[model samples]
Target: MTVNQQILLDNRPTGEAVESNFKLVQSPLPTLEDGQVLVRHHFLSLDPYMRGRMNESKSYAVPQPLGEVMLGGTVGEVVESRHPKYQAGDKVVGMGGWQEYSAVDANVPGALRKVDTTHVPLSYYLGAVGMPGVTAWYGLVKIINPKAGETVVISAATGAVGSAFVALAKARGCRVVGIAGGPEKCSYAVSELGFDACIDYREHTDVKTMAKALKDACPDGIDGYFENVGGYIFDAVLLRTNAFARIALCGMIAGYDGQPMPLANPALILVNRLKLEGFIVSEHMEVWADALTELGTLVATGKLRPRESISQGIASAPAAFLGLLKGKNFGKQLVKLI
Candidate 1:
């Protein structure tokens, strides 16, 4: 008999998330059903959006239930299988949550997908070639729809989703600018990621100052914006956007802990005739095949380079998630479970 280790959400967080909110336990594995496959997770992805799931408030997705396994994406191998669709030793990706093993039903839609790890690293399925990659593709190709010689700006530019957007937009001949927390991330964005310029948001104390700096960085004005960090960053981007610009509202990590943060310049949307659209990638399943095909090709061919900040064990996931919310993660944050 095998023992499965799991992390359960103990409590809903009030402000900042603490390790106490999650509880770890071990249990004996249950018998596999007729159409079920058993997976041993090797890697678990820790993304910023999981913060929203911790809350009880209404949002794009349903709030995570308490005392259940904390929700997450996982890449692992099938250890045992009773399902015809999957066999032992097959690599799969699914919503395996924070656990060492998952019993997945093969008949459910969007439950699991087989992956070939020969070309790209197995971990790439959790970040670059998975949800985040598709997120970048959806926002750019479907929303912003940039043309050659246009300027595209993204916040949290060195992160999994943002970095992918940088590579995608650059490939389309659009000049890209990034906004990051410190000088190091800014430097990484410009030097390693091929960004035209990067702004260190820490240098500016207020939105006005940051807007001034953003204007200087985007001299031609921002034609497309991919917003990750809201609040002042949105204000700064709005100040530099052109008349017919498009903005894809991906995330707003700053206010996820507490009350909603109001935009400093909401009127600019109407004044500039901007097309501002908020999207939830999970809700749009139609584009996954096309998005993954392009993203996987770019990563395999050396055109897209995504960085990772990996934690060594499943026990480190809570801290890694907290650090990501604080902007301490340098790139895609993951917890190695194997």
Candidate 2:
């Protein structure tokens, strides 16, 4: 029997998460039943949404149960399989959580899918060519619906989802402006990611100041906004949005710390005649195939360049996740479990 190392949620955080909240333990894997496969995880995705799952309050998905495996997306190889569809050495992506190995039921819908790593890296399945990529596609194509030559602004611009949006919007002929935490990220957004301009949010003292910077950066006014950080960033964007502007609300990392960070200007939404919609990507599974196809092609062809900030092992996941919450990660955050 193979020993499976697992990270369990030891306790829910009241405010910010710490390493103490997670407990790593090891257990022997059970014999596989028919229609089951044993997977040895190679990479684990650490996303901002995982913070919400730690809360005990009601959320879009169920609160992750205490003492269970810390929920996450993982890519791995099948070591043993009783299922006819899967064979040993097959690489697959699934919700394998924060563990070294998982015994997954092959019959479950959307539980696992084979991945081709010959062209694209296996880690891309957790970020650019995977869930985050599809998320950016859904928000951009379905909600924002940006037309050619329009101005698009995105926050957390160098992050997993936001980086994908930059590429997607730029490809559609939109002039993109990015709002990031520092000079390095802002520089990357403009220099490496093909953004028209980028504003360093840390350079401003308040929303009013940031709004002025956004106004100057977007002289044509903002036509479409992709919101990731919600507090002051949302307020600044509200001040510069053009009439009939659309905002795709992807995430509010600013409010994840249990702080009261409300939007400062609801009246702007009315005055600007903006259409703002918040979304959860997992609920829309129909578009995954198309999104992945396009995203995969972009990455493989070097059109879409998604970056990663990877930590070494499962034990490092908690600190890495906390660092991500603190805006320390440069791009998509992942744990290299193998």
Candidate 3:
């Protein structure tokens, strides 16, 4: 492709992100250097983390620069390559951002890597067998560390990371109870994702009701927790947490749009002696290979079937992403660039 269509962060969000915050632009695809590769991206990953990057405020990572392609993971074909390690038609994954093509300096380690699609689908590299999968694995295996027969709870249970977390936790013999927004997602968590039970947060709008639902679903008490959405749902989980329970503080989507989401009961941490830890999966890259191995096998063997909500083209990214923040997208959201 000679021209690259791109999404640029036009401005930071005031509160909730809107389409106007992003601008669609066209530019000549960058000319590749001798050690660079030109990749034609087929799929671009849309994730909740991108919301945090939209703000100019300090965060776990730097804010995405204005008038540049919005950053994201992508999988595509290598249409042209001048690097010795890569060649034309090679299927690869990289941080190709929000664009149809990327001129990558392949010599930069981890910027580009070939993927095998023999058993696993290429898109799965963006969700279940990729970053989301590794996020689930690290939190459960490294942080929570639940034992067999213990009950573990996850919020945003049907989401990309939550679905993977459920599968991985189930494999370790933990009773996984999921918390999702609506009845549909709750049912899917149990019937499809194999959660022991799933509490619909819609019905239980407050802490008491949600805590009661947790009490019923996890009769044994929550021994581990993988948190995504915070706010009252997290408060309810805290009320049901067992002594010395481990908790992985992942995404707090409930507060992502500049909302206040403070813990209702901070004393519970001391009362329950909770071991809560927040992490960035990228910082702990050492476990990626091992995590991807198990996650790939799960997807390849039909053990972990991840759902996806794919938008048709790059132009749809802003709207699709806005929908994702509103919980409209079911699972891993992507923009199909091809």
Question: 1-338, model 1: which lDDT tens digit per residue?
Answer: 38998999999998989999999888888689999999999999999899999999988989989999999999999999998989899999999999899999988988989999999899999998999999999999999999999999999999999889988998899999998989999999998888999999899858999889888888999999998888888987898999999999999998898867888788999999999999999988999999999889898898888899999877888898999999999989999987
Worst 10 residues of 3 by lDDT: 254-263
- Model 1 residue 257 CA deviation (Å) reads 0.9
Q: What would the TM-score be for candidate 1 when compared with the true structure?
A: 0.98
Clashing pairs in 2: none
Best-matching candidate per lDDT: 3
lDDT of the candidates, in the order given: 0.91, 0.92, 0.92
Give me the overall lDDT of model 2: 0.92
Expressed as tens digits, the lDDT of each residue in 1-338 for candidate 3 is 57999999998899988899999999998888899999999999999999999988889999999888899999999998999999899999999999999999998979998999999989989999989999999999999998999999998888899889988998999999998879888888888999989988889999999999999998889999998889999999999999999999989988888888888899999999999999999999899999999999898889899899999999999999999888888888989988
For candidate 3, the TM-score is 0.99
Go through the candidates in order and give the C-alpha RMSD of each one to the true structure.
1.0, 1.0, 0.8
